[model samples]
Target: MSDSIRLDKWLWAARFFKTRTLATTAVELGRILQNGQRVKPAHGVKLDDMLQIEHAEQVWEVKVLRVLEVRGSATVAQTMYQETEESAEKRAKAAQDKKYYREPGASVAGRPTKRDRRQLDFTRN
Candidate 1:
């Protein structure tokens, strides 16, 4: 019902995020933007403003249609904003792309473990 709302609260109320804390964390990590620039959790959001929110590997471009300071139900929250067509398309494509790379038991696979590193060092010396 407000003309402007806190960014984190808006994100939760608009259903962009599941919780206020998650929204704040996203903002802190530079994953939330307004008008193409990163924004803080406390940033004030106004109607018709554009928001770029990064979740996982996908980015969502949403337009603020209304502002509510308090969180609401899923159906009610959905009425607070609208997602751009391009953003929806991009999200769909990103999901489809991920389907190709998904493999069972393929955990990140980062750098070698400590034991492996030590063995490599000994062999080199």
Candidate 2:
């Protein structure tokens, strides 16, 4: 591995993002923060650097443990960073809450299905 890796590359290698493009987009949109500040996708990621990542309504605070440029298996990628305890707890709590209380609009993905349309029409009548 190299001495340093780009932030977007590191995020992909660490399994935080499925693709480098997504990582770059997230960084550009300020979804990824390095040491409490937003940084460009090309920013260098060093060992032990703190990163706060907000993805899909979940937030993660991880400390870089290894700098890698290549994306690897999930098990290997997991070792690249260490998530803080507080972050883990918060994620768990959020997951639990999501399980119990779902948004009313969560089931709406696209146009209503045939049955849904019928139901809607019946309600309108």
Candidate 3:
């Protein structure tokens, strides 16, 4: 019920990460930042603080609204932080781009197996 909470716990409560451990790991790996500075998992998160978080290929810029000790439903968790308009737009654009233009190697299997290589050499000679 405190106005301030641990960074990891808040991230979990806010649904940024599915679990507190993952949030802690992200914080330790420098995937989470507070007001543009690297923060520890145990860092205190207060109201109005700006957070920059990276998950997968998306970056989020959010402002802390209220701290909660309990993790709640998606709708409730969304109230804990307000994402910036620019951040939302950027994420949407990235999603659209990724959907349209994916990595060329995503569906490709690189290199042939040893057996296939042997077959190719036999067929060649």
Candidate 4:
């Protein structure tokens, strides 16, 4: 609606984060970057501005298409930014890898084996 919007507000509006507070926290923690640089939550976001956002263990590189301050439906939120091709492909690959190769310990039962404890101790040093 306006010429520009604050980074945190836009991120929330675009559904990158569930709430404005989460968006602000992410920005403060350097999880959001504007034009390849870390920015404050109050930083202005304009059309076509490149952004790198890291959330939920996934990294997104998007180009701002619409600046909005009001949260909207998922479809509308998706239209607010365009994810780069490389980012999409990378996310897809990561998903596939995770699906096929889960962490070795993910299905482990109660106690750690001697070998596991020794391996953990070796890595801790």
Candidate 5:
């Protein structure tokens, strides 16, 4: 591994974003921060650097454990960073909350089947 890497590249390698463009966009949009400071995508990432990333409606706090230039498999990418304990707890809580609340139509599962629609129509009358 090199001594450092660009923030966007590291994020891509770590699998935070599916593509480099997405990573760059996230960095530009203030969704990704380094040591609590906003940074350009070209910002250098070094060992033990802290990052706060917001994605998929959740915020993650992680420490860069290793730096790599190339994107790797999920398992390998995961090894590049370590999520903070608090972040993990917050993510878990958020996931639980989302599961309980859910989207307005998640349970509906798209348009109702004909039988279900007929039942609804009968009940409505």
Candidate 6:
């Protein structure tokens, strides 16, 4: 494995994403940041660099403890990096808040039905 790794490759190696394509897509969409600045998937990452990754409804701040060019097992990936304590706490608090403040009567999955759409319109009006 190389000492420096591509941002997308590292993300996949770290188990943050299932595949490199997904990580690249996220980076292209400006969802991944390095030291608070947006970076491309091709960006080179070094050990100890801070990464702020935004995925869906959650944000993560992880520090690169190791850099690997090749994908590795879950156990190996676990040793590749570590999330900051503050970031972990923030994530947990945000998750708890989201659970409590979730939209009432909202569908957890899939698109809304016709009836649901009508209800939404009437509620807005």
Taken over the whole model, the C-alpha lDDT of each candidate is: 0.85, 0.91, 0.91, 0.92, 0.91, 0.87
What is the alpha-carbon lDDT of model 2 when measured against the actual structure?
0.91
Q: What ranges in model 5 sit over 4 Å off?
A: 103-125
Instruction: Report the alpha-carbon TM-score of model 2 versus the true structure.
Output: 0.86
RMSD of every candidate to native, in Å, equals 5.6, 3.6, 5.3, 4.2, 4.7, 3.0
Model 1 / residue 80 / CA error / Å: 1.3
**In each prediction, how many residue pairs overlap at the backbone (N, C-alpha, C within less than 3 A)?**
0, 0, 0, 0, 0, 0
Q: How would you encode candidate 1's per-residue C-alpha lDDT over 13-48 as one tens digit per residue?
A: 888788899999999999998988987889999999
In the range 1-125, model 5's lDDT, one tens digit per residue, is: 68999999999999989999999999999999999999999999999999999988989999999998998899999999999999999999989999887554344566988876776666667
Ranked by TM-score, the better of candidates 2 and 3 is 2
Choose the strongest candidate by TM-score: 2
Best by the lDDT measure: 4
lDDT of candidate 1?
0.85
Between candidates 2 and 5, which one is better according to TM-score? 2
Deviating ranges (above 4 Å) for candidate 2: 110-125
Rate residue 50 of model 2 by lDDT: 98
- Compared with the true structure, what per-residue lDDT tens digits does model 6 show for residues 7-118? 9999998888998899999999999999889988899999889999888678889989998877789999989889899989999999899888756446535787888878
Residue clash pairs of candidate 6: none
Please provide TM-scores, in order, for all candidate models, with all chains considered together.
0.78, 0.86, 0.85, 0.84, 0.82, 0.81
Worst 10 residues of 1 by lDDT: 101-110
Ten residues in sequence with the least summed lDDT for candidate 5: 101-110
